[model samples]
Target: MSSLPPVTWLQAFEAAARTLSFTRAGEELAVSQSAISQRIRLLEDRLGQALFIRHPRSLSLTEAGQAWLPSIQEAFERLAQGTAEVFGPEPDAPVLIRATPAVQQYWLAPRLCALHRAHPELALRVVTGVWTQDFVGEDVDIEIRYGQGEWPEMVRESLGEERMTPLCTPAMAERLTTPAELAGTTLLHAAGFAVGWPAWLAAAGVEEIERDTHRLWCDTQVMTLRLAAHGCGVALAHRRLMGSAETLVAPFDIECHTAEGFWLTRPARRSLREPARRVWEWLADQTGEQWP
Candidate 1:
C-alpha cells in the first residue's frame, strides 16, 4: 500500500468487520450507520480492497477484513496494557517520624516490627534529635516529644505521662530494696533532663544526700539506661522507655511526677497523609494509650 488509511477509517473498518453490521458498529462507536458505511467505503477506496461483504438482510467480513482483524485487536490490547502500566496503582509514600533519641530507641524502635507486619506497604523514615521539631520547614509527618503536651499551634496528643523512678540492674536491685538505699548507692543521672536524681531523691524522702558527687551522668536516657542496666548505678528512667527490656529493674516503689511527658504531635494546619495515619494509629495501638 502506497499510503495507509486514516485512523478513524481504520477504526470504522475494524468495528464494522468485527460486528459484521454497519448499524451495530455505528451503535458501538456512537455514530450513525451512514457514517460507518461512509468511513468503511473510504477505507476500502484507500486500500483498493473490499473489507466487508454487504447483504440486504445481513453483513459478513471479506477475506481482507478477516486477515486484518487480529492485528487491530492485538494493537488495541497492547495500548491498553501499556497505558495501565504507566499510570496505575502507584506505590505507597514513606511516612516520616521525628522523635527524641530515647523514644526512637526504646519505644518506637521495638514496636516497628509490629507496624511493619500490620502495614506491609507503608515505608517508614525515622529521624532522631534532641529537641521537639517544628514541622513548618521540616519533612516530618509525625513527631514524638518528651515534654508537657502544650505546643501552641500544633495538634498534640499525649502518649502518656512520664513518671520517673530509680532503675538498675537486677543484681543492684536485689541489694537495695528501699528508697532510702538509693541515696548512699551510686546514682546515675541523665544530663539536662528535668527528672533527675535530685527530684527522685526528694520524692523518695532522701533529700539530705549530696547531689553533686559520686554520680554517673550522660546526655541521653538511652545512654543512662544502658549504663544503669550494666550495673553502673540506679538511673532515673521513664516507665515507657523500659519497653520490655528485662535486664533493668525499679529498685524503689516511690515514683516522681515530672513536669514533662511524652507527646505525639503533628502540624495542625495540614491533615496526615495515608502512610502517616497508619503509623500514627499503629503507635497508638502499640502503646495502648492516648490522650485527648
Candidate 2:
C-alpha cells in the first residue's frame, strides 16, 4: 500500500527538515510549532520511518530523512519557480523600446508621463535609430517604426499616420509668400524619408525648385523642426506631433500624406508576456484619437 499523507504534509516536512527547528519552520509556514511537529509525526508514521531524532536541546536527521531531504528541497524549489513564472511580479527587468528621435521627443514622450502616473512599477528604456535592426539578441522589447507594416517574425500594429506640411518661423512665413519663393531659403531634410521634399513641392505645383540644392541636413524630424523654429530654414513636419509648439508655423496651404506611418513591432513569441502586451495596448490607445 502507498504511504503518503498529502502535498501539504510534504511541504511541512521539507520546511521542518531544512530549518531543523519546528519553531522556525512554523514561523516560515505561518503555522504553530505544535502543528508543524504533528504533521511531521503523521508523515513519519505513514512512511514507517523515523525522519528526525528529537533531543532536549537540538534535532538531528535520521538516515532515511537524510536521503529524502535533497529530493524534497528540489521539488519545492521547482514548484516555487513555476508559480512565480506564471503569476508573480513580472521580472522587474527594464523593458526597452526602439523608436526614432522625432516620435520619442514629440509623441511618445508626452504620453509616457501619463503612463508613469498610472503604472509606477513599469520601467521603460528608449532606443533611437534611423533604421530597423535585428531585434533578436537585442535588448529591445518593443519598436515604434516609421514604415509600411511588414516585419518578418514580429507582430505589427499601426499606431498613426503622418502628414507632411512646410513649417517655418513666423518671420520666415511672412517673407515666403509663395512656394516658389522657398528656392532661396534653406530646406531641411529628415533622415530615412527622402521623398518629403519632392512630395511637398509637387503638391504646391512648383516644379522648377531643386531639392538637392538644400545645404542643411538633420538626422531627425524633431531637430529639423527645431532648426526651422530658430529661423534656420524650412522643415516639412508631421502635423500630429506639432501639438502646441508656438515657434513653428505651417504656411503655403499645402499638405501631403507620407508613404510611411508609425508601427508597433515585437517578436511574436515574446509578445505573449504580460508586460509587453500591456505596453502594446497602451500605445494603441494613445494613438487612437483622430488627428486635427
Candidate 3:
C-alpha cells in the first residue's frame, strides 16, 4: 500500500503552510481552523516529519517544511489543472451523459448522431449501468434514468413514457401465434423494470402467468434486446428501442404499461450548464409527441 498521507491531509497542510495561519487556511478550504490543525497533525504523523515550527504568536516553517512546501503546492496545482480539464465547462468538448445500456443503445445513440451533425463541435460520452448515479459525483453533467421522477435532491424532468410491448425475433414470432403461447416460450426479462413482464401479460389479457418461467434475465435493456434478437426467447421491450432488424416481428398486438419511465436528472443546485441543457432540450424535442 502507498504510505503517503491522504490527499485531503496533504491539501490541508499545503494550504496552511502557504498562508502560515490555520485560520486563513481553513477559510480558503472552507473548513474550521481546528479542522485545519487536525489535518496538518495527521499529515505530519504520517510523513514522520515536522512541517511547522509553532511559536507563541506566529507560525514558522522548519527546513523540512520549506523543502516540502514547493513540491506540495506544485502537486496540488497539477491536480487542480487536471480536474478542471476533465470536468470544466468547455463548449467544444464532448459532454458526458450517463444512462443505462438500453437507453444508450436504443434511444440516445440514434438521436445523438443528429445532435453531432447539427453541432459538430459538441461531442458525446455515454456512460451506462445502474451504478451511473455515481457519474454525477464525477465529471458527468446530466443523467437519463428510467424511474418515476422521484430522485431525491435532484431536478427530475419527465422525458416521456416509454411504452413497452412484447417483441421477438422472426423465429420466435413464428412459434408464438397467440398470447397463450407465451407460457411455453422462453420469456426474457430485464432487471431494471420490475413490472415489465407482469404488466405486459396483464395488458395482453393473460392472468396467472408464471414469473418463475422466465428463462433469461438480464440487468441491461441492451442485453435483453440482444438476447431477444438472437432468438433466445420472447422479450417484453421498449418499442422506441427496437430497430428494424431487431424487431423483425411483433409477438403480440397488445402493448403494455411500464411502471418506470425515462427522466432527465441533474444536481439540484447546479444550473443546467449549456451542454447539458442543449442535450436535454434535444431529448425533450424528440420525445415531445409521445410524452404525456
Candidate 4:
C-alpha cells in the first residue's frame, strides 16, 4: 500500500554501512548477522539497486548506498530530537567526553564548574583514560588529549601554548631561592617526559648537584604535583596542569617551552550533535580566560 520499504530495512542498511560488518551491525542492533544481511538484501531488492559489494570477510558500500546514508542518518537524528522535544529528554542522556587522567584531575577538573554554570541545560559526563588520541571509543563525543598533537584519523584544535615550570609548596619556595639551593630539597621526577630535573637545572644555569639531593619518582604528573603540594618535593609540570598546586608556588622564573601541547579532538568524519558541539566550542573559548 505504501510506496517505500520498511523502516527496519533502512535501519539495517544504516547500521551495516556504518560498521562495515554485518556481524558488528547485528551486535549493535541486537539482531543476528543473518538477520542484518537478509534485511539489507531485501532493501537492495526493493530499491532495484545493489547497496553493498560483499567480499569473503568484509563489506563496503556501493555508490548508491554511500549517497543515501546521510539522509537516513539525519532522519533518525531528527526523529530522536523531535521525540525528546515533544516529550522530555532522557534521564540518562548526557554528552560523554573523555580526557587523560592528568587533564581530568588538573586542567578540566577546575573549569567544569564554570562550564556547568554557563550551560545548566546541558548534561556532561566525563571519563578518563591514558591512551593516545587516536584510541577514543566510538560513543565518546569529545576528547582533550595531551601530546604533540600528531595523532592520526582525528582533527585537533589548539588550546593555546603551555609551558613547564617548577612547582613547590610555599615553604619549599622559601628554601629554593637560587638554582644552587636545589641541592637542599628533594627533586620530584615525573617519568616519560622529555624535560626533567636535568633540563630544568641546566636552564637555571646549574650544571650538576650533589648525589644525596633527595628524589622521588612517579608514574604520573598528577601524582607528582600532589606530592609537591603536600610538601613532599618540588615538581616540574605544565602551566595548564597547575590545579593541584593551587596553594603551591613557582620558586623560579625558569620554564621549559617544549614542543608539547594540549588539543581538543573528535573522531574523523563523525557529525556532532548540538549539545556536543556547544561543549567543544566552550572548551576552545576557555583558553582566553584565567586558568589555574
lDDT of each: 0.75, 0.77, 0.75, 0.79
Q: Which of 2 and 3 is the better model by lDDT?
A: 2
Candidate 3 regions with alpha-carbon error over 4 angstroms:
1-93, 131-136, 209-214, 243-247, 289-292
TM-score of each: 0.63, 0.65, 0.67, 0.65
lDDT string, candidate 2, 2-41, tens digits: 6556887888888888889999989998999999999999
Which segments of model 2 are wrong by more than 4 Å? 1-90, 134-137, 211-213, 290-292
Cα shift from native, residue 84, model 2 (Å): 18
Go through the candidates in order and give the C-alpha RMSD of each one to the true structure.
Answer: 16.3, 10.4, 9.9, 10.0
- Give the runs in model 4 whose Cα sits over 4 Å from its true position: 1-92, 131-134, 210-212
Q: What's the lDDT of the predicted structure labeled candidate 3?
A: 0.75
RMSD versus native structure for model 2:
10.4
**In model 3, what is the error at residue 13, expressed in angstroms?**
6.0
Poorest 10 consecutive residues by lDDT, candidate 3:
131-140
Number of the candidate with higher TM-score, 3 or 4: 3
Number of colliding residue pairs in each model = 0, 0, 0, 0
The TM-score between candidate 4 and the true structure equals 0.65
Number of the top TM-score candidate = 3
